[model samples]
Target: MTESAFINITELTREFKNKTALEQITLSIQEGELFGLVGPDGAGKTTLLRILAGLLQITAGQVVAAGYDLNKEPEEIKPHIGYMAQEFSLYEKLSVVENLMFFADLYNVDVKEQEDRIQKLLSFAGLTEFKNRRAAHLSGGMQKKLALATTLLHEPPLLLLDEPTTGVDPISRREFWNILTDLHLNGTTIIVSTPYMDEADRCSRVGLMYQGELVICDSPVNIRNLLDGDLVKITTSDWQEAHTVLAPLAGVKEIQTYGEALHILVDSGKTRLPQLTRALKEHNLAVDEARTASPRMEEAFISLIRKMDQVN
Candidate 1:
């Protein structure tokens, strides 16, 4: 293996009792890169992270993560990876420091190193003042941070996090990402799965998963440029009705909704802008506003998934 390729997956597939979670997934994550996995729910994001963390059994294919062959030596791989699940899996009854000590024990961290490590991690996660407080009494965001601190107790080179900031307040979510950014700057290879498009934009690279396969993986800038057409955004109370009216228009290629607004992909933005306005007027649907807008990651991702669905 080369020095940069910290995790290499080739034709990896995982199957359960009656379902296949991942199929033919081949990816290479370089050392110290922040990789984001973004997709709709049930897209096998969890399965891929579990496989890398030595938590799930792979039915076929090869995976070399953290300099250990996962198929042959899953236990050896554990020491080199720190995995944080989506839920708050730390002990609720224990104080913040206790949870860290427990995981430090599980990972067999050096006794002499435990106190210093725990003290730094508490301050690092902003849980220092709450160190004596029970984990169950911490806020949602604090609990998530505590879980992250426990994972870091092992001082693993690779971090595999699954939706770490989901369901948290926006401010707390921002705080968690700041911690991740610090880790990345310190040369820690982090692979995180998140449903938030904004979070995906912050990564060094991103992978989009669909239906058990990795559909696309690239830098966020390149992914935004992958949109084949320009976007014409329109706001209306009844976007569903507007979508039905304009979906079959000559210039409209794809229509996706952002809450009440619709992002319509078109062959030519200026030519289709007027056509869209006229069509809406003809249908007696009052559009709040219509203009050519730049495509974002959310639009590109939805477009790719739509294309994949069409191909299948």
Candidate 2:
């Protein structure tokens, strides 16, 4: 392992009774890096995080987290990592503070420091007012925050979060990312798997998994640049017809629908924009708006997935 690598994996593979969950997966994460993992369902994001947390055994390869070899010392690596699974793993009957206290005990937090740590975490997670609320009664967002707080009780330098904000309200999702940003700024290494592209854009670096393989790992900007085409967003009524008319047009690569908008990917927006507009007019489609726009993380991800699909 390199001196700067906080977590290192090589040819890491995990298998089940009759299927492979992860294969030939190799990744390196540096300390204090906010890494985002995005992928389709069954893409092995959760499996990889679980393996790093020492919750699952690897079927092959090597993993070294925080200098502890997972193959040889999975238990020793646990204290240096805080892992939050996708589901709400806390006790529903327990109050927020009680859950924190319970996790504090499990993590063997210092008795003298528990009070200060718990109080600070409550404030940090915006749960000070609802600290006494039972876990089951808290909103989905609040429950996720509480789960994060519990994971932090041990002051682990590395955090592994699997879809922590899934099914959460927009406001809560933003708040959760805010806390993660603060943690990143304060030198915590966080590896989070998220289904949201906006959240993936906020990461220092992103790893895209597909069919159990680490397909691409790079900065958000670089990933977006990999779209291989320009994006042209066309807003119009009867988008179904507009899509059909433009989909087979020259230079058109792909089209993604968003309500009344058709985000069209083409070889060249400059050359294809007017061509597409004219075709829509010929078809008598009422074009409300048509313009070239920046390709976002979502477009890049979808493009990559499509390419992979074609290959497979």
Candidate 3:
């Protein structure tokens, strides 16, 4: 392990019955880094996180977290890590403050200092006023906030969040990410897993997992830059016909339609755009607009997946 790694997994594998939950996965997350594990459901994200949190035993390979061996010294690593599972785990019948107090006590927090930490967490999560409300009565967003507050009660140096923003409204998602950013700024290493592509872009580093395997791990900007071409957005009256016509065009690598616009990836400096316009016109499709645009994270992700599929 390097001097800077907060978490290190080398050839980690996990099996449930006869099924493989995680392959020989290896990754290194730096200190104070907000790292995102992005993949669809059943991609082994939850399994990997559980292993890192020492909640589940791994089938093979080594795992280290916060300078302690996950397999050999889970108790030593436990104090330095906080895990928030996919489901909100608070006691539904208990009030928000009561739940926080319960978890604080579990962590052996001093009674004198517990109130100050609880108050700060409540304020940070915007649940100050709802502190007395039962967990079951709060909205989904508020419940998520309370869960987060309880997780942070111990002030662990590493936070493992399993789809924290899933099922959250857009505004609430933004708020949740803002709170994560604040923690990262304070030197806490955050490892979050999500299926949302946009959320993956917000992390300091992103790992794209597919079928229990990590196919790519890099910064968001570097991932987008892997697509070697100028992205052209084409808007035509007949999207179906336009896509059909442009799909076979020379230098066209991929075509994705979003509403009325078709985002096409092509080799840089290719004159395929003019050819596409002419072809659409021949098909009686009105070429209302066509212009170059920057490639988004989704584009890069799709491209990487396609390439990986072809390789396998």
Best by lDDT: 2
Q: What is the C-alpha lDDT of each candidate?
A: 0.93, 0.95, 0.89
lDDT of 2: 0.95
The digit string of per-residue lDDT tens for model 1 on 123-181 reads 99999999999999999999999999998998889999999999999999999999999
- For every model in order, what is the number of clashing pairs? 0, 0, 0
* Alpha-carbon shift of residue 179 in model 3 (angstroms): 0.8
How many clashing residue pairs, candidate 3? 0
TM-score of candidate 3 on Cα atoms, chains taken together:
0.95
lDDT (Cα, 0-100) at 276 in candidate 2: 97
Candidate 2 wrongly placed segments (more than 4 Å): 1-3
Give the per-residue Cα lDDT of candidate 1 at 8: 90
Candidate 3 lDDT (Cα, 0 to 1): 0.89
Question: Every model's Cα RMSD, please?
Answer: 1.5, 1.4, 1.7
Scored against the true structure, residue 67 in model 2 reaches a CA lDDT of 91
**Model 3, residue 70: displacement in angstroms?**
1.5
Better of 1 and 3 by lDDT: 1
